[model samples]
Target chain A: MTTFQELRLDGVRRRFGGKDALTGLSLTIRRGEFIALLGPSGCGKSTALNCLAGLLPLTDGSIWQDGSRLDTLPPERRGFGMVFQSYALFPHLSVRKNISFGLQMRRLPRDEVRRRTDEAIKLVRLEEHARKLPGQLSGGQQQRVAIARAVVLEPSLVLMDEPLSNLDAKLRLEMRTEIRRLHQSLGLTTVYVTHDQEEALSLADRLVVLRDGRVEQIGTPEELHNRPANAHVADFMGYRNLLPMKVKAVHGDTVALDGSGLTLEGTPVGPVAPGDDVVAGIRPEDLRAGPHGVPVTVEVVEYQGRELAIEARTAEGVALFLRATERPSPGDRITVTADPSRVLVFP
Target chain B: MTATLPDRDTSSTRVARRHRLAERGIDRQLLLLAPALICVLALFVYPFAYGIGLSFQPAEGGVFGAYRAFFTDAYQRDTIATTLGLALPAAILNVAASVPIAYRMRGRFRGKRVLTTILVVPITLGTVLTAEGLLNYLGPTGWFNRTLMTIGLTDEPVRLTNNYWGVFFSLVITGFPFAFLLILSYLSGIDPTLDRAAATLGAGWWQRFHRITLPLLAPGLATTFCLTFVLAFSVFPSAVLVGDPAGTTRVISIAAYHAAYEVYDYPLGSAIAVIMGLVELAVVAVVLGLRSLLYTGSTGGKG
Candidate 1:
């Protein structure tokens, strides 16, 4: 039996012909840790996941699973259970058969295989639909079967590649909770890949944000969300208000910025100096309607269930979007402000 | 009643009547099938009906004379078994060889189109050309024997041509490309991720193929088998040129041809042709029946 300890990816690189899909990814995953590889499409998150599963050979570098070199092994030898975005359940097989596939592949005893598959089906709450084929089941049920298939193998590491992407929005949310519960209860070292930032933030113990086939940043959800490494990351992490400004003054931790419609005091992230051209980023929620701020005419207002998302233009026609508890209509004049700590200045 | 009704209602009824006429106009879309329907009627149905009529009017004895003669004569009856022996093995071999080959070529790769084009060259060569090529190539003093001698595997030239094997080989060469193309398309329809998923689940390559790929591909294989069998069962040119036609390789089609043209027994030939067709249909039906027994589930995408 393989003990749960650490899976080390040391300089994982994958090159397709002349083009590099995954340049080099090196990360250590502790046992029971949920790691989310967050990136936009074509950022090599899937490629990295495939490499970890040994589905794709690395152009360079090595992987170690609990001190044993893993890169040289075939995918079957890697013993990783993966849930695909398309589910990829053998359409010819029934739900029970699909769930029991991995166990049967391992040549497990008949009774044990049956018991484990039954338990997994129950765990996914798909016992009623066990006899039906994947095509006969709804999208949610198929997803549950896929999850059951992967986890039934009882592999220390589970690799999920945008598993919820094919589900409807409501089903996606439901399955997200189901996945999180599965991860916590089973204590699986899960490496999930997704383009959705919110999904990565919600489920991951640590998040690795990638861009252009490279890791932009890797930290806990709060760390990456609060202290983004650069402007690209800040923008991706829902810092929607990225306004250009000239740095008026720099003191200790705060830098003052002067813009046509937005005069803001922001925390310095990287190097900043007086008179330097910088971009100040503020999240929609961070910007609120208050006094002693830039007067802007609201252009669009969106109702976001409990709050209003207001898009406005400044006196000089710079666009600003802010979220407020108070209702504001379009074409209304309002002043918005940002706390110094909430504002991030990127040069 | 019409006079009491409004003018609007009367005009609307007239329009509705015209719409109903259009809808009932012999299903306008079926007119598009005119060329295909005509071809089937003229080429297949008329010829088949004429053969059936000719078969019933026996040249001697009674109306069932030709069929009775075929069943009573051991020589004629043996042709059915001979044709089955030749066609069944040839079709089975063709499908068996192509399945693995097509599976390997299913995925996209460099020069795939070129490879497929080269592989299908034997298909266009036809039975006549292929038989002649095999005669020259597999003859006693041919390069194949020369190579065998040079390799020192055998001192005597191996007898490959001028026998049942010659015709079998010809059928394989000619029919393999057709089977390969069909099976390749079927293999391509199956999702590659299914195999990958199986692999990650601890299945080895052979296990994945045995358990997953083969089961999903069974129906397609059955179809390829039926088509290949039809191609092989009607063995005329190859049997004459390559096989020992009068003795060991005397297939049913040769019996039909011999009876019709050589002996001037058209009714007997018609009866033989009918029997041949029935036998082929029976084989195809059996294969289809076996296919039904397999898991013929949908291999759709994104599920």
Candidate 2:
């Protein structure tokens, strides 16, 4: 097997009509790496994937693989496989023919096409449905066929656009592990576009957080979860409590907060100065109901089988939500504390 | 109070009987449909049965008199071959030509609505008007022939009307729109993402069309071809107006007309009509059977 090199998207920009969908987007995808493009809808994650796949022409910039230019090529010439959001399986073709379609297009020998198609069907665990049309199969089965159809080609890069978005929760979970396993077994470089943070977090080796067609932060899942660069990134990463507090004093890495009606200390993750307005973020799991903490009035208590989500309002009218193992009634007064290290302050 | 209770019970029983009658209203529903049934029987079934009866009436031969005469006579027997010769080619050409045009016009662009409107103009003209228009447009001194001569494409004016080409062109003019509309609808019903998926799977444009689009559109195409053939087979007005009705384009309808009106032989004419119907039925059945073999229902994402 030949060792694949790297694919680099260099300062890619895309415009639709007069509106910019992507602006100066750049990323490097190494061989056998699983990179997840995570963002909200219309954040240009899909646009970026389309640009790399040559499905859409870039307004400026280029994509390079190894030493050759790929952006100038057409989608079919790019030789990259894409799994669309709709699965987009040929409804009229049997699963075997669907999987063998690319090979047939390449005019491969019939025996080899049959051999690879059989392997792909077994790989996707769809041997029983090898003769079934896509319409006759279940949604999960159809999606498996779609996966086999793309991977059978054995292209260098596999691009998926919200492939699991249409599935039910249970199926999505099943396919998530299936995708991860396939990527590992095939050793194929993959670029996945999804709006689901949890999916990206669990599946991706590296996460690229995008907002408004721009990269907000790019890091490993743990790095993004623990230390998001700004308030927006933190909010997207499940940080529920974002309090706008004025910095009263600073001592090394610790900063004192004011106007939040509490003498709380938070660690400054980004540059901060005295008297500067900073947003202090804390994850719901990090907040604990303890004795030495700020008093809050519990506004809502939502039961979750193993834990409860407690929504509370601070003395200064700042709303926050925290998770608790013990159930608390709404309108009850409680003190919630967060560790200084867990709290992130961004200016 | 006791007297009122007995009376109320009787009235309730009557209401229950009425409800029962309502539930078993099959006869009533048939009665309601009597007018449509009467219209079909009188206007369609009665005439059809009467024509069959007339065809079986004994003439010079016996019970199978008219049919025997038609098969024995060269002119009448040749009409079937001639009509089919013209209709089949015209229908096939119309459907085959419409596919690429419909495929190109499936997506929206500037002047799409106007183009569609223009395409359907021939259908709106009807057979009579289309024949009249073709007579002038395709005549010896008509603009079509004159233009060819003026452009030095030909030394003399070409003969276009009152021949096989004239009737063929008229059938195409009328049938193309019908086939085009049907093909366009089938093309539009397909999800565009299917083609995009094929493209990503290394299929070029022609491959995508041949594998995905053509297979999916098979059923619609067969149906459109049958309809257009039927429309072309009964080409009486064009055959008489812009065709050599006594020679090349003496189609089945013209023969049936001459038998009934000119020769005053209604039995022979009715016999010809029955044969025409049987031939159409055979073609339609064959086409529909082929459609079943080719059609795999729809295969794409639900729109």
Candidate 3:
């Protein structure tokens, strides 16, 4: 096990032209942890990954990997494996040659190279295509070959940049499970970057969500999904039902909200003074159909196989999506409620 | 609603239309090739068949007399040896000199545009002008001789112009740009990702170039060599302008021209031209065989 001393970023700054891509951002990554840098496009998640991989030079920062300074090292010298989004396979080489390339570079013996090449091919389940060129394989197969090539070196940290975005849905699911299993088997530290929230939720052991080139929040998947620190985190993690409210009264274990006629029973997320404007965040799946639900006019009802997602507009003109068993048609007057414990109040 | 297929009569008419369309496409293709096909048939095929016929027949009359003289004389056999000797080495030298310049120019820099222009500018200069430039620069009593004299390196001018070396130099200079451009484009067209992947796999620059770049560029090199070889083998203008006519640069084409124009013997000239074509075909076949050995499984000459 490698001990990571905070993987500190001391005022990391990157700029392109006048706009700051990574603006003096600071974050720490624990060793052996699979951290997904989650953000929208152009939020500098990829820029941050490139800096960590030593593929991009930082304008001003110090990055130390396992107590050794990494700023001076080039990508090849960094001793970390990188899997690009494009897979970047050698088109001229057969699958076996591609996997054995790194070992050959080490000037290993012929027998050893052959053994490791077989092992890497087996790891990706591409033994049958060992003699075929990369161009002959499908996109998913090519990506697996890329992973096999990266892992054959046994680097301590593996960096992946939206590696599954190119794959079809079914293949994406298969690769996600495969990547998680491979990560566990090897016990290698991984930094994955993706804009897809479900991908981050399903694959990452911890999520480092970024916004405008700064760390918005960092926690386990459960912490960020259930109790987001702010509006942006909540919205990013699929909290589509956000309503504005004022803190009318605050007491232990329960808070009274003004306007929209709602009282949420939960501990305040952070320090919230009285009369502070706050937004109540709730996942659509948490709301239910009940007698004491807020009166709303159903606008559209979409059946998503297992659950019915109903969009309703309240009398106050605020729209909210309620997931329920009972399907309501458009223009139907209804009431939707949620367990107060699941509601998140953020200022 | 009842499911129905298209009417059979309509479908049959559509199929007939498609058949007619395909026939029209074939006709169009034939039409597109007609001009080149007719030219090759008239000028190339007829002449080649006639040469074979003429070469086999016994020399009886004036034009056939030269053919009879060529086969029976040992002195005429020496021309074949001299032609191959000069052409093969000159072709090899041209190809060898183009590789490094092309490799260096693969990447971009400030003076890259200027350097490329300078390199390609030589191609536009005709063989006559190049020979003239060689005469001015490399001739005895020219700048080269004056420089050697001023440096106190030589007591007299050195002989370079009006020689085989002058012809070879002119060939290399004029032939190099064509080969270089071919090679440079091929080198640059190699997906750079291959090298990046190699680097990530722990291979250094030399290893990557050796294992990947050179092997992939082999087909391109073959094509460039074939083109330059044909050009060198058929050399006539530069040989006449810059080279010694006294048995030095009497390449096959020059011999054919001399027989036809100066010696006023058309049948002998045609015979020599036929021999030159045969020699060229043989050389090209050998070069292609060598190319196949280097790039064993590739399709030839994609460009």
Q: Which should have the higher DockQ, number 2 or number 3?
A: 2
Supply every candidate's count of residue pairs whose N, Cα or C atoms clash at under 3 angstroms: 0, 1, 0
- In candidate 1 the C-alpha lDDT for residue B9 amounts to 88
Cα lDDT for residue B127, candidate 3: 92
Q: lDDT by residue for model 3 over B1-303, one digit each (tens)?
A: 233445766789988987898877754466889899999999989988886666444345554665666667655656676667767787787777777777777776689988888989989997989999999998887899999999999999988878888888888888888888888888787766566556656676788788877888877787888888888888888888888766777677877777778877667777777777787888889878887776334221233
Model 3 vs truth, CA RMSD: 5.3
Backbone clash pairs for candidate 1 read none
Residue by residue across A91-175, what tens digits does model 3's lDDT show? 6678898788888888789998889889989999998999998878999999999899988888767889899999999999999
lDDT of 2 at B197: 85
Per-residue CA lDDT of candidate 2, range A1-347, in tens? 22359998899999988989998888899999999999999999999998988878999998998889889987888888899999988888888988999989989899999999999999999999899888889989988988888898898999999999999999999999999999999988899999999999999999999889889999999999999999988988999888888998999989988766655789998889999999999999899888778889899998988889899988888788898888789899988888889989989
User: On DockQ, who's better, 1 or 3?
Assistant: 1
Provide the lowest-lDDT 10-residue window in model 2 chain B.
Answer: B294-303
Pairs of residues clashing in candidate 2:
A91-B299
Error of 1 at B103 (Å): 2.0
Identify the runs in model 1 with alpha carbons over 4 angstroms from their true place: B1-26, B149-156, B301-303
Which rank order by DockQ, best down to worst?
A: 1, 2, 3
